[model samples]
Target chain A: MSEQLTGADILIRALEHEDVEIIFGVPGGAILRAYDSLYDSSIRHVLARHEQGGGHMAAGYAHATGRVGVTFATSGPGATNLITPLADAYMDSIPVVAITGQVGSRSIGLDAFQEAHTWGISMPATKHNYLVTQVDEIASTIREAFHIASTGRPGPVLVDITKDALIGKAPWRGPGQLDLPGYKPSVKGHPRQVTSAIEMILGSQRPVLYAGGGIIRAGASEELLAFATQQNLPVVTTLMARGAIPDSNPLTLGMSGMHGTYTASTAMQRSDLLVTIGARFDDRVTGDPALFAPEAKVIHVDVDPAEIGKIRNADIPIVGDAKAVLGQLIEAGERALEGAPAPERSEWFSTIAAWQRDFPLAYDQQPDRPILQQYVIDELSKRTDADTIVIAGVGQHQMWASQFWGFEKPNTWINSGGLGTMGFAVPAAIGAQAGMPDTTVIAIDGDGCFQMTFQELITAAVEKIPVKIAVMNNANLGMVRQWQKIFYDNRYSATELSSSIPNIVMLAEALGCAGLRAESPEEVVPTIEKALAINDRPVVMEFVCDPDAMVFPMIKAGGSNDEILMGPEDL
Target chain B: MQHVISVTVENKPGVLARVSSMFARRDFNIHSLTVGPTEDPKRSRMTVVVDGPEMEQIVKQLYKLIHTLKVVEHVPGEAVEREIMLVRVNAEAQRRGEILDAATIFEAKAVDVGAQTITFEVVGEPSRLADFLEIMKTYGIVSLVKSGRIVLAKDTKSATKKQRKSA
Candidate 1:
């Protein structure tokens, strides 16, 4: 049945058909018509303090739930504000659909009020975008936008509609056909490639499974665990793939990269075969491309064909969905090893075990002294459940959380890995908490990162989202300060944050949330317990940590993984 | 090395701007670019000549664009190419006869003849047009315009036959 409807109504109907439960945005002049239509619908709207916050919130929702996140904004400033999160989603391969309201078509180039060339600005950042000038095209455009955003190698997509288009009337039919002929993505792995990969896996003496975010994105953590266990291979998860495999597993090496574990990097450097699944060999992961995994022959499996051999040459490149490829690999392995015992690798296991024991992740702590940042994270990890979602901001605190948190399942660790955007924790935590209302959500943020987007705590309090926030108050830009101390002749230039900083506890109280402070080691446990006890509103717990703490086991930029700086002794 | 790339994109507003902006952002210099409607009404063809060492990367990146339907690199021997040039030169009656003689030699057509100048149109290889323009420059050239190179791949049968003969 066809009925007369405005473009705004058509857009809302399309979103409803797609089962979009919530939208994070702030309404403005150009989008007022859509907001009016939104009021008459059943979907919940989350008002963010800033457009960037809304965009990050949408990203968090998508990252946690594996669903297409939706956000709306006005044309000029609103669209510009969305650039950071768009770039963030693009770099991290998150699926997000952003809708913006542009000035009427007639006044697009006349320098009208709040007019911007949104489609042009978003071209490089978005996977795809559309500009709708007709009312009848709204439904199909929305359908296509969702399809493109959530498909293979998902990323952000934008759709900008002119105000005249929104106000215009048309007969509302259901979402029409998506007629995009040039946008097909491959989903099944080639049989010959799968056979070759299995042969390599079975023949190697020293093999390491380098799992990446694609495993989590493909929701194939079970298959990965089965395959790794079946092959008796050691697994190293990258920063974005932290929770893809349980850290408690005997074969797991925490993270491999700039601040990765000594065992993981050494394993990568010494292994004969490095099978990479769903993870790009980023500069942070592969410190020096020529020297990284020098003895390893790579087998890369990813859904995007362009990612294969982009940085490192793949001996066996499989372009297919991670889940499908992993399934095929498992079946092929079972057939190849039929009625045969698994190869014994006691020698390889002992070597890796020695590395793990000799250079375990450790930090010094003294009783009755200033609190250590690592201690705070350790305690939080101890107190939280295995299914708790831990989100962090960028910089030193991000590294600490990634190291200290014991992730046991996928979708439990979320952070800004690719773009390294600070101020991502509070709003992202709120979004994650909203998406998974029954699960506990925690944001571990640094004092520097917290100062960037802490205003979103107001939204959390008003919306009654109970998320626990832990601020590791180091009172300085810890990472940059450490770098200056080491490489810049110990000249502390512009890294300190102790000058005229606001009191965080009072700030949180002012924002209508319960705030607690822990200055000593004794207060850490009680404060965290109290914060965890709150169920009606959000709670912020501030831990005054030592400013001199540094992330160790560091591979300096442009340095090989073999030249790892373990600590001050090495320096 | 200089490489010519042809791109097919959906016929929509601002696509040309998008393509140019991509080149500008990547800092890839475009030696010449010509865009026009193709036989398919919904799509347009663009011919771009670029000077770079990363032509493979450029082709891959261009294909990543959502609106871009197809991209192909035009090899010199496997493709037929042409360029059109229109030149208006100073011709004051006595020089008109000499200019007409040069035009005839170059297989050019006299399109317009004003009181003091004459316009001639020529179509040929880019090198030939450049040589003709050089000769016309000596006759006191007034204005000139050169359409960038346009290309079409030869039929598949002939291309394969040539490859077999080379092999």
Candidate 2:
């Protein structure tokens, strides 16, 4: 007979079997047993100040490391708080597994204390969820949660366990068999479709390679670079795919979107064929779907069939893993190119180069102007190591960081891309730092964003994670203020954060972090040097930036990308 | 035009909720839905009748669910559809013979007979059931319940995976 273990023990064992290195969560009344079991386990737990911070941290770890990130919370408000992060992960397609403790079995429908339908409440947000009614089901629930999280087009999954089941005894059977019959994700591209796509690529005069975060998730960066370089196709990476193709490459056209580069925006509008790989044409990327790429014939490739024709119709839809499909395309291209002239898209390249030269990403770093946020990002990019992972909170600073920082590698850029959640940088930096211990992790945040989740730094300080934070104190909600200045007639309704803000440096010191501030350009490098020297604890460096700077190359909401503004002068 | 989507799923708690919630979020127009155990105790079948465009998306989304095993959409003329209903109608002494005569013509049996009412159980095509219910309404309907709709391919060639094994 197999030995018996409590449901909590089974859960901890299953997580360990899945090689979970760390879990971010808070302990509460309902999850006491699970916490007790975790105390003696091999897995490490980082106690979070709030469930929401922990949820984002898990997402950050998943986004950075390409592994399933895990978090735990008690029922009711604790689980409800995770909904936002789960929704963010769903929209961005990150792999996160969230586990929550529910009330006792008998108290399920009796309005028990701290009880909420965790599974039901998180249904719309999570990729899948489990409501455990039996102690024996804990093993399979944990296994399936991890599987569902990391497979196909990855997203978050939730597992809600009852307190009674956690304390109840069940036989210690190792990993339970997964019974998911409906989840069969296609890997290889269909042969006929691949041939058709090759024909389109070979026949087209102006072809562009569009890549999204799926390349990083599939680890197809090498394949992407090889294909682009071989075919001499100009490549455009989205915000989520900054590192898929290095921006330094002569063939790369940087990003394409609302605040994307002028060269990339123009190239996408003029391309005759767009070979879209792993990217869903999000509204932000393609401002107006119908008028997005008027002359382009789309050959869309994605693992999810539903996303193939969800928005814009695809002339050739290939549903398969990005890496597998790219690998297939490379081999097919070699055979098809035999004895044929090597294709060279020189004319298209020259057009893109002229745009880049005319409108390079420029910022006024004049000594007369106040410390500019873009200048700080440029300085940080020059000083940081090649492997440094940059996490950004949503706002004007996010655009500035993406715009200024020369991101040339995959898995090095992390942000709340789809949901655009503010306050993601602080905890997410800590989580990424914890996941990649040898690499430097920095959080580039705005004043309004920093104040939202800087408290999570205490967890890093006490844990000695040594993540750095750079707060751009522009004295206002920069992004919203810019919008109000442009769209809302400068009313500035509730967008100002400068009226009565706390001293961020003092707040950082109070949280046991090395705090420094730079108000002038000369002071910037010295403060950054001082912050980088601190290895024992986290450092928070505040840069008092100009409030007038707004993100450029703008496309107004519901406007077509064909009419992209170049800069403030264009506005 | 309405479309019939037949899905086979594992018999488990919350499976129905997962399937129904998916439909609600996708905004699929569900005219009627029915679920019951299959020959195998571990599996169940659901017949959902939905309308509107995006018929391809309806099937694609259902296949995304973890518990779903198979999904088949039944075309209009290639499949047979039926509905079962139990309708109770008011029967007065003067109207008893007339109601009985109407039920006889429609091949419906009196499952229950109270002093003032008679419950008729009938199984037929949806249109046939509507025709029978039209005549019974003259005697006045007290209450009625229906088993939405169940569908099957006209020939045995269109059998499910499990059905093929049993055959």
Candidate 3:
């Protein structure tokens, strides 16, 4: 009545049950059995350079495909390495599954070789975790892991299977009736809460819709658009929620954050009512928690109950999946708007349009002056259509890209937002390119952030993914140096870089990629054009810029939203 | 509204912090808490009393926390609960049997017997258990150990599959 199966067999079968198409992972000694079983399964395995890279790769793939991305690692360092990525995914609320191989059940706790307390370490990062000692429990554990990872307010789940469980022969029952007594993911919205939110929106004169990533993940974008159009309400998206409404849609205001479009940010600030869907109010998006949406009565809707009023007060909090909740709201809106005239907000719309015209994000780079990072990103964005995916590394370059490089959609701009993980860009771009092979992948990296994982150039070349990389070579940790200059009275202190890296052009050539350098504004557009023309292999363009540049309009940590610091304003 | 509930759980990673954070983020007021390993090394239990304005909100949060597998059961102490409190009282050697008789009357078992001290293990619902310990206070209580409040449904088997089936 039982089939002879290793723990790996059960794991793969569990993943198959969850309809996972691909998994990203790196093999290690303790985890070889899982790889062996994976060799036979239909699921595609992407071999990444490091376990952390594997984690980001999985996250990028998940973000792109809207399915939970799965990854595996060996015990000890392998498990520890995946921790940062797990934390990043958790903060961003992306669904992922990280399966780590553990030391054999017998060798655990003896200070065994390559043994780390993975379950304990990843406890805070994962939505849930399982340490399987018994081989018979593997299938159920994995089944539960997927259920937890993809359920209410999806997040990363870790399953640490011991080596014995992976190698040992067991009768796999094929994930039979998983009954975890305490785990329940709510799939439906509270009827009363949803009705109240819809009522408030209907009653308001100046109402705005703030959509987040949850809309896309819930597959509710169409519902959102229908509701917005029917009600004739303007919609704004968080950076993560970008493609929920197409940027070209007249009702859509690009993105709302620190560098969010003036129209969207102003509208959010002035609206009588704001309906937040599937978006956590990240600090970057909400400049100061207390002052954010001060004039607006907030209606926060999300799948996770804990997120409601965690930072900001919610006048009406609807707990449910965004799509389900939106569906209900749309139905209510349809019923209410029958033969009714649309509410007028002509004056408010005119005021917001005026702000957009006056404060449009524009920097005129002198054609004769040395190239700036902003100029490079602007040129790249101008040449490329909105279809390109732009992944950024942490530093001044990342800030510049966020401020200047226009993103028409979410998942198109991938970066570690809350965790501020550096060395994220290249691997993330690699993963994004892998996920969407037809789309152009661009990694906007600083000189400092590029060196963190530049070795991944080999990954791009090997995978034959023609990703375009624009390196803003400022020769310093520019963002830190900017803080030092402004806050620490110009004490540079460990921020400067005197050493030279392999001239990026030569490095790109060595890695079998087309290398180009742009040191002037005129060269910026031409370089991007030249690089995009030759798409057979990957290309890396190095743009040299002033090392002392800073991202403008920055509200320092612990500073008020009104106290924004534009560059050189102190001077 | 305030409710004091104890939960029996499997000692595992992130369980305590997760439960605590859930309460903190939900703005639930936690009045008192005590957590320790149980008689079974494989399991740990926690007793938490939360005071908040809304009873339903607190219960919903508790339900969510209880859904984590580490949490075996969370039940209100006033409803159906037990605390096995061990009290070591200083008793004259001659009066040991009398104390034993008292322990028998209280339905307590003698866990430790000594020359001048008699220790009794009392397991009952919280109120009865507290009465037994209060009586022991008259005997010059030397020390006491309590298993906090390990709770169960008044009708355990019935509630497990009945009310919680959808959960």
Candidate 4:
């Protein structure tokens, strides 16, 4: 019954099932059968410079389109080459479906030419993977991969089909109704749990709401805003949860984490009710589990029950989808507050506002010193508000951008949060720019991280979706060195990294985009202004920052939040 | 406590990396894992026993961790997970049959009836291998090779999913 269908037919059918408009990859000999199937399909096949680039392109497309980005590669190096991007997607909670053609099953372990153990190489990076020995599983396998990649936390899934599976014919009976008893996604929030959470919220005098990326994934942004506004709750965001609440909203607090604002951190510390909606409370967000929100009774509402109390203890865990949970909460809150006066935690709100006023993201001017990355990021934030989408790579610069950049909209701030992936900002910005070409897209990258995916600059040029990349070149892996300085007692170790930082101007010119370099604090503003002026092509501005500078409010490993060492002197 | 867990995942590309990376990201130290063909040709069994205190979290994370794989916990006291070890012991020709008799008692196979030496394949849990190693050392064990732990669930159904559904 499963015969008469080759692997190619199954792949084509699966793409159709996924409604995949495009498949990005660089084809090789091993995957010719899959390529053959794609020849007549309506889905556009974009050939990239390299297989790795194909993976990035798919990731970018997914980020912009809010759809599952699809990529394919031939066997051997083609399959192995995609490991980096797969790892990137796996870390950032991006939805991507990577399909690779494999050598025949019989040739799997024989080490045939172009025969590589892709399953082994990719196992660490994907949510799950499949090597379909029989042709019948193709439709079902692809369906499951798409479902898994986009559901729950949303991550990448890889499917490797053998050449024989692709060539041998089997009767295509479409994905058989997908009746996996174990695979049902949690769509509705647990009702009794929701009631208990509402009771806690209504009882608290000083309550604060914490929302995460799950809100955006669940398409519950409006619901979040409405609920917070109705309940008079101040909201804070995780790095991924940036756009879930508008920064301009009166109740919105800035992002929280290793680089979180003092106000958000303080609010978290002092709040009586910590209502976490769709957020995982990662270690990066909650510095130490033992001391995080110590006084607050947490009510966690998330689609994935596994996330509840994973890092911090949860008082009330309502396991269900966020959108549905929010709806239930809104209804219950309305019923509970009928003809009753609302409680205004004005003192708490005033305290948070006071902190925001005192700090206000300030930076000191050094007349003759090197340009500071924080000043540059602050100026960019000043120039563009929430409408602008900002992406950043991990490092001292990423921390600075997260702290300094005042993002207003959800999906406006993109970063590799949990994985702390370097070289993520530039390509991700390119992806964001592609999705909303009308909106200004800015990528803040560090010197060491930018070079990782700088090759994608050519793709930006070709696609004509220009994204401005601001490179904070400190000539070192700043974050690692900061850790070494604090934890290793000033021993630099192997953290001192010096590589030729190409004249970003010349590189930008080479890539057919605008280029600027800021050597001092004064030049930072003009350079960013110049880059923003170039609307047609992408721009790369290299800002040389103080090498010895460190990310302030650093919570050392196994250290409490109170142990944060802010500057060089503290370190 | 550290645990060695074996996962039976559909034989596919990058599955091993996915599992190992999860352990690394979560800072879960994996003792050992072995992947090979199972009774079902299409599905490969990964005998990975991970040791950790938050076994509940580890078990919960596994469901969110994969799409097609089933994680069955086979801890020492509750479930059955076994290991196989082959040890070459230095035994005189007269004592070979006695060693073979011991091997038979343990359901072990005489892989190599070597002259002046004998190699036996013993299959059991980690403790069993330790006992066998200790007994073989009495016979002046010359060399030994132990297969990394490969685990399986005692019941046929995936237990984690059952727990989740009940929860």
Q: Every model's DockQ, to 2 decimals?
A: 0.24, 0.32, 0.25, 0.20
Candidate 3 stretches with Cα past 4 Å from truth are A1-3, A13-21, A171-177, A259-263, A565-567, B1-3, B6-46, B50-66, B69-144, B150-167
Interface RMSD of 3: 5.1
TM for every model, in the order presented, reads 0.93, 0.94, 0.85, 0.81
DockQ of 3: 0.25
Q: Candidate 3's residue-wise lDDT over A203-286, tens digit each?
A: 787788988878867878888888888777899887667667767687887666665666676677778898888887878777
**Model 3 chain A lowest lDDT segment of ten:** A558-567
After superposing candidate 1 on the true structure, give the runs of residues whose Cα lies further than 4 Å from its correct spot.
Answer: B24-29, B86-120, B130-145, B157-167
Candidate 4 chain A has its poorest 10 consecutive residues by lDDT at: A176-185
TM-score of 1: 0.93
How do the candidates rank by lDDT, highest first? 2, 1, 4, 3
Report the error of model 2 at residue A387, Å.
0.6
Point out the higher-scoring one by lDDT: 1 or 3.
1
Position A432, candidate 2: lDDT: 90
Task: Judge the docking of candidate 1 as incorrect, acceptable, medium or high.
Answer: acceptable
For model 2, the stretches where C-alpha displacement exceeds 4 angstroms are: A339-341, B86-122, B130-144, B156-167
Q: How close is candidate 4 to the true structure, as a TM-score?
A: 0.81
Give model 3's share of reference contacts. Answer: 0.30
What does candidate 1's lDDT look like per residue over A1-571, in tens digits? 4689999988899999999999999888888889989999999999988988899889999989999989999999999898888888888888999999999999988988998989989988888888999999999999999988988788999999999999998987888569676566667788899999989988898999999999998999999998898778899999999999899999899998899999998899899999999999999889999999998999999887667777898999888888999999988888988957567688989999999999999987686878988889999999989999999999888998999899999999999999999899998898888899999999999888888899989988988888889998888888888889788988889888972367888988998789999999999999999999998889999999888878988999878999888887888
Best by TM-score: 2
As for TM-score, the candidate ahead, 2 or 3, is 2
Error of 4 at B23 (Å): 7.5
